[model samples]
Target: MNPRKSDWQNLDLLLKSFAQISSNFIYDLDDKKVAELDVKLIESHLSEAGHDFADVLEHLCDNIIPQLSASRGPRYWGFVTGGATPVATFADWLVSTFDQNLSKDGDSIASEIERQTIRWLCQLFNLPDSFDGLITTGATASNFLGAICARQFAGRRQGINVAQAGMANLSVEVFSATPHASMLKTLGMAGLGYKNLIKVDCLTGSESMDVADLAYRLQVSTAQTKIIIASVGTVTATDFDDLMTINQLAERYDAWVHVDGAFGIFERILEGENLSNGLEDVHSITLDSHKWLNVPYESGVFLTRHLDVLFDSCDVPAPYLAAEGDKPEFMSLGLENSRRFRALPVWMTLLTYGKQGIASWVKRNIDCAKLLADNIAQSPNYELVNDCKLNVVLFRPTCSGLDQQAADEKTTQAMKAINQDGRIFVSPGYWQGKKVIRAAISNWETQIVDIEIGIACLEDIASKL
Candidate 1:
């Protein structure tokens, strides 16, 4: 028999083995080391004639699994990652099994499911029905979509078809106060040149944009077409820009506004907080599902009110892929022409856990972050860098004997020690010119016990340092 046929015959056994290994690894994740690797030894396993399917699975279990980090575990606080919900995980497996190409609308139900999911998401965020959206790979891709639409809007304002005629000799002015790194990367990738971005002065003692400064700059600006990026959540401190004021300024200046609400848009779901004050007034928005939605990786969504501009920016006309009826093909919406069924997990998770369930998750995570922040505030060996806002806590190592530079060094060392201890995972970052450790508590699985474990890890590391 051929290799493909043999593998197909043994698929049941392979799936059984995979289930066992995955269950064991997840059960022991709390006690397991985050990562264990020997690069040279792993490299030695590569060979010309590939091994059998069973042997390949065995090799993966033995060599590759140990090197992987438990980033999906409750205590993994690095990169603001989220754990996959049970229903989402099951939906993801079905997505892989079905393997539907979601680019076209007429072929399967995937397109409709995606459409409904997008509608549901818009409702969840209190967006108007006029907003059109598409699922993308991640926040970077979503931000790229927003950039493309913004560029298109700017070009249209200047009487230029940038997609067809090119950005030659054209300059679209972009402004942001504390823009995310992904947005800057989008500027470069969108051919706007990262150097063209105008860095607006932030509010004193805060990462949020200074409205008066922004107004002054906009009034004095000479560029005909402008795009303003408003941050929903700053990376280090989780500070939010004043979106209402920024949108008002955008309207006054005739600028296209894009809100990078990657992880912070979920804050809107919580009651008594108008965090997304002017979200509905913006031209475009970028939201990440993998971060706070507690879905698996490779899921983000970009929404815009300018469907015509989006079509002008992203559509590539072809006779073979002609538009069918009134519906727009998913392929003509964003970067990828062959999209995966990413909306399944999101749809399933949303259905399984309605608005109330998601709100509870967000509230619990915010409480957990506050709990950790309180511990850090009361500790003598650590300094709380920023007030606990939403679900992120920033802090650094500090002692009476250490100077500024010495304290920075100690923070770095302590961060390393805590991560190496492997009971929990946190990331190192800089806040306001000083090195700090940032713990982003976004995972649905994270609880009070996990926060306590993180606290214990920090205390132990501080004592050792």
Candidate 2:
């Protein structure tokens, strides 16, 4: 188990094998992004219990390598996924090597680096200096942290500590127009009933919420404690809700505002962009560095202006985890007591690629998305479900003399046809009563050629249908 016992020979071998596998995986994707996985049963023979590292590595290369999907490739449009940069990938390797416990008391360097990264992120998002944040598992955990903090903040206003007293006879209302599913899951996990989420109506013919409808909902809500969750970038359509208006309504209603920026929060860095404007006014925010920041998986950020309330919500006093002087202890904050050095990759990414460098890729992805939507719009076989905003293009297959149900079936079939070919991948979901294909371009490697390839696949699939 210890590579050092072999004088680091096995470690060198493993490193070389990793490099080879990475090279092969990237180059092999030229033909296809994914291969059909062979479903097989494992052996139960006791004689095959132990194997050398070299043998195990060889087995993994042969069996597991080809079966994996190239989700980090340019043509993987299945979800809003980001490809890793060379520097960030290397930093991730160092993270695994060091395996440092990122607490405030011990290994203060890791905590200081995390705080510095937070400061850089604030500058990137143009947030105020008074805000504090933490890195979590992903958007789900980030949103969950925001929800729990909002719950606690609301409960405290009523002189109730929900974390200690639980949600016993306490009434707290939540509102969201087109929240990500993770937000609902957060509410459920935070002991707030999912059914209690008052769904606000979106604007006519768009996913953006209607400000008037939100105002009306808030005006009529009887709950003394309220939470309003808004999305800066939705997963399906990549549509941005009216953040300025939502925050205004929240202020009027005396509600805590939480924005799930997720992958789209980077749009705030773009100049003259009014989509996510005033997002900083919210009480809390959710950001996913793994999506647009090109960081590895399980990297998310949750920022809040209410640091006192956040600490009150998740603080757990321990005997040995005391903080020194004014240093903040992360174990008393957020979900986990022991977390990986997740901040290293993010810090390295920001340091290596400055704010302008990262913003360029974001703008590029947005442009590529527009190109995809334009191509879809020109094709007679497909109908654009909505206007392209940010980096998502929502569209579906269409045919003459077909009813709505028939069109829906054709749209779904088109998705299957394209994905089955394995040249590229796109996701399918319902949007405004129509089954639509969602092509999101968040990967740094995505280019106009990738969009062209995806369009070609869809056009061929539409021809057969």
Query: lDDT scores for all predictions?
Result: 0.87, 0.84
Residue clash pairs of candidate 2:
none
Number of backbone clashes in candidate 2 = 0
Query: What does candidate 1 score in Cα RMSD to the true structure?
Result: 1.8
Winning candidate number (TM-score): 1
- Error at 258, model 1, angstroms: 0.4
Per-residue alpha-carbon lDDT of candidate 1 for residues 221-295, written as tens digits (9 for 90 to 100): 888888998889887778788889888899998999998999999988888978779999899999999999999
Candidate 1: the clashing residue pairs are none
For all predictions, the C-alpha RMSD in Å is 1.8, 2.1
lDDT measured at residue 8 in model 2 versus the true structure, 0 to 100: 69
Candidate 1 lDDT (Cα, whole model)?
A: 0.87
The residue-by-residue lDDT of candidate 2 on 1-465, one tens digit each, is: 676786765677778888898888778876754435344544656556697778778878777676777787777777788878788888998999899988665545888888899999999999998888889889999999999999998888788988889878677899888888889988999988788899999887776788898898888888888899988888887778888888888887789999999988888888784678888789999999999999988899999998888888877776667766675688777899888999999999999999998998899999999999998889998888888988888898875688888988888888888888777888887888878888888888788888888888888887887
